[model samples]
Target: MRQLLYQLIFFILLGIPDGRCLHMVNFFVPEFANRGDKVILECGFSVNDREEELYTVKWYKFDSRGKMSNFYTWTHSNQQPKKHRIEGVKVVMRESNQNFVTLKQMKIGSSGTYKCEVTSKRRNRNPKYFHPNENPPRFNVIEEEAKLQVVELAREPPEIQGGRGNYFYGDDLNLNCTSKPTYPPTTLTWFINDNRVGNSLIEDDLLYKDDDLYVTISFLRISVQPNLFRAGEIKVRCVAEITEEPIKASMLPDKKEFKLYQVKLPEAMKLSTQTIFDVPLFGDGCTNKLTKFILVIILFLNFMF
Candidate 1:
């Protein structure tokens, strides 16, 4: 229809007739930043005219209440907002590219609708025509609102006590681990050197208290022991898993180390006037003395001395 109108105008202006052509250029400014942020508004030009003409461009901003304001202007002599408020926001022509506008250090008050207005200039005509429709046609520049959020870091586990005792191989070992509660409850797992242990039974009896600030008390009860087990310093470890990583507090052995010892008593006691010399040197029998001969000899030696 615009081409038809231009052809009709050309027929009226001159004696030539041409087919109709309709061209519409739309403005688009998708999103903007908040205060202390940067933004770039784009405005492109499209023309449908037989005569090549020069185009003039300008930018405006509108608010939610439909209040319009001239935030930026682009033409032969560039014009910008005069209010001291927008001084921090520097609008650059984007390296001599008239179609794009770059604003830096944008402020919250600069949030509004922006329109890129372009006016075209014809060589022979005094009246200028804007390539983009100036009426109800403009790009909107809007500043997004900021929001505040609080994030709590993972908490440390509490000190553990009791539950220490002799654990025979294959006997069930139950250990209690506790910690402060965390958002999206922390994942818990038990590991034996890198092997994952299941928690179906332990999770069943997990208790919570203290305004739920206290984390889920995990009771790890291992029903089986590995083949490397012994009464020696077998590292009985309790690892609490929060997140994918493990936070561990091992079960240290008591101060006194355990050792196996054996003691054998003599089958019978030998009684004689003289000392028995057939007893083994390392046997318990060496610790006891024969009575009659030893006592009499000791008395005679004392009298001689």
Candidate 2:
């Protein structure tokens, strides 16, 4: 219809008839933004008419609930509510909405559907000998939509819930990993000595403390062997990774890194003197008199010195 309208106007302006030639152009690209990131949404259009025209651009927001509201409008200047406040969000346009509108300090609340409608109306003059019914006027309308998702960065590292323990041989170690609630939720994994805990049975649980927060707790139970760690310590760590299922594939996933937890190995039982004593290292078989002999020898040596 736009091409037909252009042809009709051209024929009338030049006082000639040509109905086969027409042209149209359009461009559309969606926008993506992260939480607290500065974003720019673009909406551009073109017209083939040689006559003077007027273009109007309006930007609307569709919230998470699917509710839509008009927020900003531009004809040649700003024409939207001034007193209304959307936290840390603003729209900047130059040359037109052709360049795009900026959203500053974007937040989670800034997410949703952003609709930009560019409508161009041509002011076609009626030829002196033409009738209004000869050509049905056409108007240009282009609507582009972009969905913005504000992803919150993971804040808290995964923490061990219970305190340190005295794990001994044949003991079953139960480690609880809890990560600070995060957007897009998080998966908890247990690691021992910088390796994933693969030999244990793990149970997962989730707790919702806030709308933006989704906490996950994982219980890892593994058999402890006094042989595996004879003396030093056992190092365990928990990693909380933001699942990409909730976010688009195009966006980067967030993750939290936690420091390792060092659990000291239990001390070995002391050997008692009664268990083995009075045993001579050198020439004696039975040492009942060796202690006395050794004591006398040490005393004589000291006196001589």
Q: What is the TM-score of each predicted model, taking all chains together?
A: 0.30, 0.57
Residue 252's lDDT in candidate 2: 23
Q: Where is model 1 more than 4 Å wrong at Cα?
A: 1-26, 32-35, 48-52, 76-89, 93-96, 125-305
Q: Mark the regions of model 2 whose C-alpha exceeds 4 Å error after superposition.
A: 1-31, 76-98, 127-138, 170-172, 193-200, 209-211, 227-233, 246-305
Candidate no. 2 TM-score: 0.57
Tens digits of lDDT, candidate 2, 1-305: 99999999988978542231221244343344555666766665555455434366677788756877766676733443221244435654342344366667776567677787776554456656555687655556667776666655455467776533354445566668777755556677766655566644788876544334456778877765533342355666677766544322212224343221121211321111101011112222234357668989999999999
> What is the lDDT for 125 in model 2?
66
Candidate 1 CA-lDDT value: 0.41
Best by TM-score: 2
lDDT of each: 0.41, 0.55
TM-score for model 1?
0.30
The local lDDT score (0 to 100) that residue 12 gets in candidate 2 is 90
RMSD of each: 24.3, 15.4
Q: Give the alpha carbon lDDT tens digit for every residue of 77-184 in model 1.
A: 444322212423367544324456677655434544566566544333223653444433322221212211111223353323334444444445565555445321
Worst 10 residues of 2 by lDDT: 271-280
